[model samples]
Target: MHYVDLDKIELKDIPKISDPDGRGNLSVVERDFLPFTIKRVYYLYDVPSSSTRGGHAHKELQQFLIALSGSFDVVLDNGKSRRTITLNKPDKGLLIPNGVWRELEDFSSGAVCLSLVSEEYNEDDYIREYEEFMLFKSS
Candidate 1:
Protein backbone atom coordinates (compact mmCIF):
# COMPACT_ATOMS: atom_id res chain seq x y z
CA MET A 1 0.00 0.00 0.00
CA HIS A 2 1.14 3.51 -0.71
CA TYR A 3 2.12 5.54 2.32
CA VAL A 4 0.00 8.40 3.53
CA ASP A 5 0.93 11.80 2.17
CA LEU A 6 0.22 15.28 3.33
CA ASP A 7 -1.67 16.00 0.14
CA LYS A 8 -3.98 13.23 1.22
CA ILE A 9 -5.24 15.32 4.07
CA GLU A 10 -8.97 14.73 4.39
CA LEU A 11 -11.54 17.45 4.86
CA LYS A 12 -14.67 16.73 6.84
CA ASP A 13 -17.71 18.95 7.00
CA ILE A 14 -19.64 18.68 10.21
CA PRO A 15 -23.39 18.72 9.72
CA LYS A 16 -25.72 20.67 11.96
CA ILE A 17 -29.12 19.22 12.68
CA SER A 18 -31.95 21.48 11.76
CA ASP A 19 -34.10 22.58 14.64
CA PRO A 20 -37.55 24.08 14.31
CA ASP A 21 -36.81 26.57 17.06
CA GLY A 22 -33.30 27.10 15.72
CA ARG A 23 -31.89 26.80 19.20
CA GLY A 24 -29.25 24.43 20.55
CA ASN A 25 -28.27 22.66 17.35
CA LEU A 26 -26.05 19.66 17.78
CA SER A 27 -23.12 18.46 15.69
CA VAL A 28 -21.07 15.30 15.92
CA VAL A 29 -17.90 13.81 14.46
CA GLU A 30 -18.21 10.10 13.98
CA ARG A 31 -15.23 7.93 14.86
CA ASP A 32 -15.29 6.31 11.42
CA PHE A 33 -15.01 9.72 9.84
CA LEU A 34 -11.74 10.30 11.68
CA PRO A 35 -8.65 8.17 11.41
CA PHE A 36 -8.18 7.94 15.16
CA THR A 37 -10.07 8.36 18.38
CA ILE A 38 -9.97 11.87 19.80
CA LYS A 39 -8.58 12.00 23.30
CA ARG A 40 -7.77 15.68 23.75
CA VAL A 41 -9.04 19.07 22.69
CA TYR A 42 -7.00 22.27 22.51
CA TYR A 43 -6.95 25.60 20.75
CA LEU A 44 -4.42 28.30 19.81
CA TYR A 45 -5.26 31.93 20.16
CA ASP A 46 -3.43 35.25 19.96
CA VAL A 47 -0.69 34.52 17.45
CA PRO A 48 1.92 37.19 16.91
CA SER A 49 3.17 38.40 13.56
CA SER A 50 5.57 36.16 11.63
CA SER A 51 5.00 33.39 14.14
CA THR A 52 4.37 29.73 13.29
CA ARG A 53 3.22 26.71 15.24
CA GLY A 54 3.05 22.90 14.93
CA GLY A 55 6.26 22.45 12.99
CA HIS A 56 6.52 18.82 13.90
CA ALA A 57 5.28 15.33 13.00
CA HIS A 58 3.63 12.79 15.24
CA LYS A 59 4.70 9.16 15.24
CA GLU A 60 1.37 7.60 16.13
CA LEU A 61 -1.13 10.31 16.92
CA GLN A 62 -3.71 11.85 14.61
CA GLN A 63 -5.27 15.31 14.74
CA PHE A 64 -8.21 17.22 13.36
CA LEU A 65 -7.82 20.98 13.05
CA ILE A 66 -10.65 23.47 12.92
CA ALA A 67 -10.57 27.21 12.53
CA LEU A 68 -13.10 28.30 15.06
CA SER A 69 -12.63 32.04 14.82
CA GLY A 70 -10.85 33.49 11.80
CA SER A 71 -8.51 32.00 9.18
CA PHE A 72 -5.11 30.34 8.86
CA ASP A 73 -3.05 28.18 6.55
CA VAL A 74 -1.78 24.75 7.37
CA VAL A 75 1.32 23.54 5.54
CA LEU A 76 1.81 19.81 5.49
CA ASP A 77 4.72 17.72 4.23
CA ASN A 78 4.98 13.97 3.84
CA GLY A 79 8.61 13.71 2.58
CA LYS A 80 7.46 13.60 -1.06
CA SER A 81 4.46 15.85 -1.56
CA ARG A 82 3.52 19.05 0.23
CA ARG A 83 0.20 20.85 0.45
CA THR A 84 -1.13 24.00 2.05
CA ILE A 85 -4.72 24.12 3.27
CA THR A 86 -6.64 27.19 4.33
CA LEU A 87 -8.98 26.84 7.29
CA ASN A 88 -11.66 29.49 7.71
CA LYS A 89 -14.81 27.72 8.84
CA PRO A 90 -15.66 26.17 12.20
CA ASP A 91 -17.79 23.46 10.62
CA LYS A 92 -14.89 22.27 8.51
CA GLY A 93 -11.75 20.50 9.73
CA LEU A 94 -8.68 18.81 8.32
CA LEU A 95 -7.67 15.36 9.41
CA ILE A 96 -3.91 14.95 9.68
CA PRO A 97 -2.54 11.55 10.44
CA ASN A 98 0.77 10.46 11.91
CA GLY A 99 3.99 10.71 9.84
CA VAL A 100 2.92 13.99 8.25
CA TRP A 101 4.74 17.12 9.31
CA ARG A 102 2.49 20.17 9.64
CA GLU A 103 3.01 23.87 10.17
CA LEU A 104 0.44 26.53 10.96
CA GLU A 105 1.22 29.91 9.48
CA ASP A 106 -0.26 33.11 8.10
CA PHE A 107 -2.90 33.53 10.73
CA SER A 108 -5.51 36.17 10.06
CA SER A 109 -6.46 38.62 12.78
CA GLY A 110 -8.07 36.93 15.77
CA ALA A 111 -7.67 33.41 14.46
CA VAL A 112 -8.61 30.54 16.75
CA CYS A 113 -7.40 27.12 15.72
CA LEU A 114 -8.84 24.14 17.52
CA SER A 115 -7.18 20.75 17.55
CA LEU A 116 -8.61 17.32 18.39
CA VAL A 117 -5.79 14.97 19.19
CA SER A 118 -5.95 11.19 19.15
CA GLU A 119 -3.21 10.58 21.64
CA GLU A 120 -1.98 12.31 24.77
CA TYR A 121 1.07 14.52 24.74
CA ASN A 122 4.34 12.64 24.53
CA GLU A 123 7.62 14.26 23.59
CA ASP A 124 9.07 10.96 22.47
CA ASP A 125 6.30 10.53 19.88
CA TYR A 126 7.15 13.71 18.01
CA ILE A 127 9.72 14.10 15.24
CA ARG A 128 10.66 17.76 15.30
CA GLU A 129 13.29 17.85 12.56
CA TYR A 130 12.49 17.67 8.88
CA GLU A 131 15.35 15.35 8.10
CA GLU A 132 14.46 13.12 11.02
CA PHE A 133 10.85 13.00 9.91
CA MET A 134 11.85 12.05 6.40
CA LEU A 135 14.02 9.27 7.66
CA PHE A 136 11.29 7.97 9.93
CA LYS A 137 8.77 8.09 7.11
CA SER A 138 11.01 6.20 4.73
CA SER A 139 11.73 3.41 7.14
Candidate 2:
Protein backbone atom coordinates (compact mmCIF):
# COMPACT_ATOMS: atom_id res chain seq x y z
CA MET A 1 0.00 0.00 0.00
CA HIS A 2 1.16 3.51 -0.76
CA TYR A 3 -0.97 5.02 2.03
CA VAL A 4 -3.20 7.51 0.25
CA ASP A 5 -6.09 9.27 1.94
CA LEU A 6 -9.38 7.48 1.37
CA ASP A 7 -11.21 10.78 1.21
CA LYS A 8 -9.37 11.59 -1.97
CA ILE A 9 -11.18 8.88 -3.82
CA GLU A 10 -14.45 10.20 -5.24
CA LEU A 11 -16.60 10.70 -8.32
CA LYS A 12 -15.70 13.07 -11.10
CA ASP A 13 -18.00 14.50 -13.70
CA ILE A 14 -16.92 14.14 -17.27
CA PRO A 15 -17.78 16.70 -19.89
CA LYS A 16 -20.90 15.69 -21.77
CA ILE A 17 -22.06 16.67 -25.20
CA SER A 18 -25.84 16.53 -25.44
CA ASP A 19 -27.51 16.25 -28.78
CA PRO A 20 -30.64 18.28 -29.42
CA ASP A 21 -32.23 15.56 -31.53
CA GLY A 22 -31.96 12.96 -28.76
CA ARG A 23 -29.31 10.86 -30.44
CA GLY A 24 -27.51 10.39 -27.09
CA ASN A 25 -25.08 12.09 -24.78
CA LEU A 26 -21.37 11.82 -25.30
CA SER A 27 -18.75 12.04 -22.61
CA VAL A 28 -15.09 12.50 -23.35
CA VAL A 29 -11.93 11.86 -21.33
CA GLU A 30 -8.82 13.70 -22.23
CA ARG A 31 -5.34 13.50 -20.80
CA ASP A 32 -5.55 16.76 -18.87
CA PHE A 33 -8.41 15.69 -16.64
CA LEU A 34 -6.57 12.76 -15.11
CA PRO A 35 -3.61 12.55 -12.78
CA PHE A 36 -1.91 9.78 -14.72
CA THR A 37 -1.30 8.77 -18.29
CA ILE A 38 -3.64 6.06 -19.50
CA LYS A 39 -1.78 2.96 -20.59
CA ARG A 40 -4.66 0.50 -20.84
CA VAL A 41 -8.39 0.49 -21.44
CA TYR A 42 -10.84 -2.29 -20.72
CA TYR A 43 -14.37 -2.97 -19.66
CA LEU A 44 -16.51 -5.49 -17.81
CA TYR A 45 -19.90 -6.57 -19.01
CA ASP A 46 -22.32 -9.48 -18.94
CA VAL A 47 -21.32 -10.22 -15.39
CA PRO A 48 -23.59 -12.31 -13.21
CA SER A 49 -25.50 -10.31 -10.63
CA SER A 50 -23.96 -12.23 -7.75
CA SER A 51 -20.39 -11.74 -8.87
CA THR A 52 -17.97 -8.99 -7.85
CA ARG A 53 -14.87 -7.61 -9.46
CA GLY A 54 -11.67 -6.17 -8.04
CA GLY A 55 -10.37 -7.20 -4.63
CA HIS A 56 -6.97 -5.67 -4.39
CA ALA A 57 -4.85 -2.55 -4.00
CA HIS A 58 -2.26 -1.30 -6.39
CA LYS A 59 1.32 -0.42 -5.67
CA GLU A 60 1.43 2.35 -8.27
CA LEU A 61 -1.38 2.05 -10.79
CA GLN A 62 -4.35 4.38 -10.82
CA GLN A 63 -7.73 3.74 -12.40
CA PHE A 64 -10.91 5.47 -13.44
CA LEU A 65 -14.09 3.39 -13.49
CA ILE A 66 -17.27 4.47 -15.19
CA ALA A 67 -20.67 2.86 -15.43
CA LEU A 68 -21.22 3.18 -19.12
CA SER A 69 -24.48 1.30 -19.28
CA GLY A 70 -26.41 0.46 -16.12
CA SER A 71 -25.14 0.66 -12.53
CA PHE A 72 -22.78 -0.84 -9.98
CA ASP A 73 -21.26 -0.18 -6.58
CA VAL A 74 -17.60 0.12 -5.71
CA VAL A 75 -16.52 -0.62 -2.17
CA LEU A 76 -13.24 1.00 -1.25
CA ASP A 77 -11.09 0.10 1.74
CA ASN A 78 -7.87 1.77 2.81
CA GLY A 79 -6.74 -0.39 5.73
CA LYS A 80 -8.20 1.96 8.36
CA SER A 81 -11.52 2.85 6.77
CA ARG A 82 -13.99 1.85 4.10
CA ARG A 83 -16.56 3.48 1.84
CA THR A 84 -19.06 2.58 -0.84
CA ILE A 85 -19.76 4.53 -4.01
CA THR A 86 -22.55 3.87 -6.43
CA LEU A 87 -21.88 4.58 -10.10
CA ASN A 88 -25.08 4.86 -12.11
CA LYS A 89 -24.47 7.71 -14.46
CA PRO A 90 -22.58 7.58 -17.72
CA ASP A 91 -21.08 11.02 -17.30
CA LYS A 92 -19.65 10.41 -13.88
CA GLY A 93 -16.90 8.07 -12.66
CA LEU A 94 -14.83 7.09 -9.71
CA LEU A 95 -11.13 7.82 -9.70
CA ILE A 96 -9.28 5.29 -7.58
CA PRO A 97 -5.73 6.19 -6.76
CA ASN A 98 -3.07 3.71 -5.84
CA GLY A 99 -3.05 1.97 -2.41
CA VAL A 100 -6.82 1.93 -1.98
CA TRP A 101 -8.61 -1.39 -2.21
CA ARG A 102 -11.71 -1.69 -4.40
CA GLU A 103 -14.47 -4.21 -5.04
CA LEU A 104 -17.20 -3.81 -7.63
CA GLU A 105 -20.59 -5.36 -6.96
CA ASP A 106 -24.36 -5.05 -7.30
CA PHE A 107 -24.18 -4.81 -11.05
CA SER A 108 -27.46 -4.26 -12.77
CA SER A 109 -28.48 -6.19 -15.83
CA GLY A 110 -26.73 -5.02 -18.99
CA ALA A 111 -24.28 -3.07 -16.95
CA VAL A 112 -20.99 -2.05 -18.51
CA CYS A 113 -17.97 -0.89 -16.56
CA LEU A 114 -15.29 0.94 -18.50
CA SER A 115 -11.90 1.09 -16.88
CA LEU A 116 -9.02 3.38 -17.81
CA VAL A 117 -5.83 2.47 -16.07
CA SER A 118 -2.51 4.19 -15.60
CA GLU A 119 -0.43 1.11 -16.13
CA GLU A 120 -0.35 -2.01 -18.25
CA TYR A 121 -1.22 -5.49 -17.01
CA ASN A 122 1.38 -6.33 -14.40
CA GLU A 123 0.64 -8.89 -11.73
CA ASP A 124 3.48 -7.76 -9.50
CA ASP A 125 1.96 -4.30 -9.13
CA TYR A 126 -1.08 -5.69 -7.36
CA ILE A 127 -1.52 -6.30 -3.65
CA ARG A 128 -4.22 -8.95 -3.54
CA GLU A 129 -4.46 -9.85 0.15
CA TYR A 130 -6.16 -7.57 2.63
CA GLU A 131 -3.74 -8.50 5.38
CA GLU A 132 -0.78 -7.82 3.14
CA PHE A 133 -2.22 -4.50 2.08
CA MET A 134 -2.65 -3.49 5.68
CA LEU A 135 0.85 -4.54 6.48
CA PHE A 136 2.17 -2.54 3.58
CA LYS A 137 0.34 0.56 4.78
CA SER A 138 1.98 0.29 8.18
CA SER A 139 5.47 -0.04 6.78
- Show how many residue pairs clash in every candidate, following the order shown: 0, 0
Top candidate on TM-score is 2
* Model 1 bad stretches (over 4 Å): 18-26, 30-33
Tens digits of per-residue lDDT, candidate 2, 69-118, equal 99999999988889999999999999998888899999999999999999
Candidate 1 CA-lDDT value:
0.86
Tell me which residue pairs clash in candidate 1: none
For residue 4, model 2's alpha carbon misses the true position, in angstroms, by 2.9
Question: Which regions of candidate 2 deviate over 4 angstroms?
Answer: none
Residue-level lDDT tens digits of model 1 in 47-122 = 9647999999999888899988899999988788888999998888998888888999999899999999998888
